[model samples]
Target chain A: MKNSFVELHARERALSLLDAKTAREIVGPLDNMISPHLEPQNIVPESDDGIVLMRGMINGNNVLVVSIEGKFQGGGIGEVSGAKIVAALEKVLEENKQGNTIYPIIVLDTGGVRLQEANYGLLSISEIQNVVIALKKYVPVIGLVPGRVGSFGGMSITASILSYLIATNKARIALNGPEVIEQEAGVREFDSSDKDLIWDTLGTKQRSKTGLVDEVVDDTVDSIKDAIVNEIKTKKDAHRTENVDFYLSLLNKLDLSKKLDIDSYNKLYQSVVATKHEVPAATAGNKEGTKSRGRLWFEKLTGIENATSSISTVLHAQKDGKEYIAIVPDSDNKFPRVREGEVGLQEGFAVASIVNKIVADDKDKTVKRPIVLVVDVPSQAYGYQEELIGIHVALGSSAAAYAKARQAGHPVIDFIPGDAVSGGFLAHGLQSNRMIALDDDSITIQAMSKASAARITQRTIAELEEATKHVPAMAYDVDNYEKLGALYKLVKGIGSWEATDENVVKIKQLINEAITSLDGDTTLHFRYQTPIAKASGRKATLAVRKLVDEEWSK
Target chain B: MEKLHFNFDTKDAISKPVHVGVVASGDLEVIFRPTDKETEVNIVTGSDGFKEVWGNVLQRFFDRYPIQADIEINDFGSTPGVVNLRLTQALEELKDEK
Candidate 1:
């Protein structure tokens, strides 16, 4: 009889991977640590917060297995759950930094952000990515997707950053689920009930063949263990998010006129030649570009009116020794889903290409140019083709670029004058160390659209709205988002579209203020260190961090 | 969500702490810690108005094996059978450790 890894819960999964009798669980269920946000929203809180942090040996090598219990709330990452992952990974980073050499294996079975605790999920996921990038300097950070709510949403983007990825045939990986696409785009874009099409598009076998997932294995525990052990020995890093040239070249070949199918996409995937493509800086176009808060702000800040680039959606320019990047809407864009400025395949790859260029240009400079992100994305492009082509990698590419830029000591700042929602926000806004946003109600910041969030959480729109009043993280408006203490300065008296001469000056001063306050700090610790965060925003996160730090060396 | 607390005057003292089950759909997680005091059960369940069912289930469980422990259950609409099965599962682990 074969033991199926996918059938086990998170704790059992972690134990099955570790050496017998050597496994010790940190922050176990008996600790009484639960999500503070759940019960208040009438949701039952899990004892261990659906995350299992186990430390032991994998084949006599030091290992830490972080497993997400998919059976619980679809493994949705809440405040406590997100903090648990961030704290454990940070401990791994500390251990690796001190030469202890503990391998961190993440078993991903998440649907990205927990809608119940939305902003914290985004913040925690970004923090987790930062630690993963830092840990890569020492050892390979391994990832495992063992079916049963396989990696989706922002966690899939995190999966793209891991050194190596292994998934069983039982798993399926994508950025947005089919149901979400149907809810957001339309039923014609993706029929949520069409299970066969979904599996064929997102299943691990297709993913492996198309280079989304690195390797696919049998669902047996022994097979997954062997794969993990082999990856540890070989130190195989897919560098899935670093393949900017390949994706850009693939995008160049992709004909937007025809709807992409599996066979044609596979053909295109095999035919990519990976040419050295460089995205030129944003320039003043002859005609006025599509109007958006992002485009308007980019135009005012960069002083390049009608700012447009060859990529059409992505606009980047250097002004006064600072690099400004924006993903704006183009109503006439050939990619139909991204016309309203969603972070689509082209926008993600294009932003990565531009940011990577900036980092490369300033590689040896002590005074690295600060990168400002003019964020106004409504969401990530929701379409069948975007999912089929691995939009997570596109989003991950730019996110990894921004993280790498910030990690390399270039101050990354986000100026959110408009909507920053879902994967669009994850790919663009969340990586910045300091965020300066307008105190305007026009801005909508959240993990998913209300309709999709309601459907996914099995709550009515009214119930979801009611919960938002109690939980600041659940609310979509920027005013509610500020309660999370993630922003550096929420500037008042400035409307989203009112970029007057004086307003632009005020915004510019705040941006400079944000950059100077960085003081060479690269970590996302500023979010937690804020006064509001300490008081209530991230109170649970702080406690979890303290607990994990105390429990790590034991 | 409903919170329920129960106290049982049991005699057999549990030797160690044990945990079993998951708070998945139609299931529940039970955590047991050894205690010198009376056996206490505290539950935060997704289902409402299950106080009688839970009491009966615990009554039958403690009748068979009166183990003194601090019990905490986080349930998500598990049936009486599942509640008994998970309690028995934790009981089996307790016996295995012994």
Candidate 2:
């Protein structure tokens, strides 16, 4: 039998099972709401519309359901379809205002924008993301992935961007599908064949184990329904302490990737698989150590087109008698060599000192400047010698610097003038309160190529490409990284160094406006979209806010 | 391909499907009911020469849990611990009247 929510509308909306008639209401074209993409593709349009918008009562509470069918033009979304989803989300938010919180359940199944429709689908996707983000404010977005057409493309990325994701053992999530990797990186990288291996790589189990997916269940309606009901019942319960420590402990263990090999990866997998660690509980109310007292303001200054050829530069303070400084701390594990005689200190000490300087410089000033995190590291230093020297601490020190800047009423605004990859990117680029990439010129997150991932997965690139035709995440590029919410913006350019007198003037104006709305003490506003505090802390109230909002509005 | 029809009426066999308690490691469970209609049995496995071995095992278990039902089994190297538990649990769940 088809699952209640995933199957066709007629089956899902049947009034027989539900207590109220809301569940079975006809939507879409059945209600005359067909997508514009279907007409062009010459596909027989689904009567209820491509976007399944089901409104009904589930277990005594009102709920909203939004789903996309992969079979229909690969479920590529267009304006009308996107608008319907946003409308449903907006309605949920309105309901929250009225005290009848709605839940938003997105049964994701798509390959992304309808390539045939071109930019229409792409623009629609942006709007959809905005809607989802807004809906996240009032209610939680429960991402559900199932069926033969695993979530990928924009839909999959959206799922990843959501606060809580529920995936079946059958589901898979990724940005670039496998075929794109094969095309760009060549066949040596990813072999899409060997179904078992591919499934293992992108399966829900792998994602859940990695903490990307919140839950994994059997492919059945009852299993899913039961889980949802469980959340609803305990939505007001306190959070567990274990979740808080999990992130810190996981960060401590992140080195598994630094010395990555098949053997080491397998060992890590075995350790996780062999034991189910009891996640610690979080304290009720705002815990002392976790609260932030001030807001961090960030802005951008576009660099020159070709003359300076830099997006944003991290300038060093003066050294000796000169106003210019050089040689910070040794960062590279192997070549702990600082840029000798250079105006800036060594990379290691520079990151630490920059935080100190930025915070101190802005302390007495009425309006604080966003710490400009000048990033331009090609790759993390790699060598056997470096491994023994504890690179994690070096990276941690850099993280500490960003954390300090964030706590001191300063936002870490990272400008990627060049390449950012792996741990290097996480240490600098990702640490920013918000990261904005330079339009198409910057190479953001997603290091190596499909070939690299394929090599790691042990599949021939051609085979992987062929397989990716069905598996969507492998078909990706730098542009696809934007869909993952990693790159907050693709700006034209932040302004030039020569125009700095004017640039600083404009930058200060923008900074002043941002700071005006902030509470002087709070360093940051936990992006409300995050359910980590609720899930790990097991804070029932926090959990309810998301649950109620999702049910009523989304 | 061979065709086989199966129907067993065991004294203690249950007639409904109900709660789900275990789907974790080392255990599998489901329920079955004799809808008193057309039902069939088919078992194919990669493990060599286990047809009669499986048939006899199913026949004995069906008698013990005698409930009329159609049974289908797909094996992926399951252990003996799993086989008995799955059969019993499935029977109990089928007996549960939702």
Superposed by TM-score, candidate 2 places the C-alpha of residue A511 at a distance from the truth, in angstroms, of: 6.5
lDDT of 2 by residue, A163-248 (tens): 56777776666544555434443444444564665465566766665555677777667777766666555442111111322332
Mark the regions of model 2 whose C-alpha exceeds 4 Å error after superposition: A1-20, A24-27, A30-49, A112-140, A161-164, A236-554, B1-98
Superposed on all Cα atoms, the candidates' RMSDs to the truth, in angstroms, are 1.2, 17.4
Q: Candidate 1: interface RMSD in Å?
A: 0.7
Looking at model 1 chain A, which ten-residue stretch has the lowest summed lDDT?
Answer: A1-10
Q: Clashing residue pairs, candidate 1? A: none
* lDDT of candidate 1 at residue B19, scale 0 to 100: 89
Q: DockQ of candidates 1 onward, in order? A: 0.83, 0.02
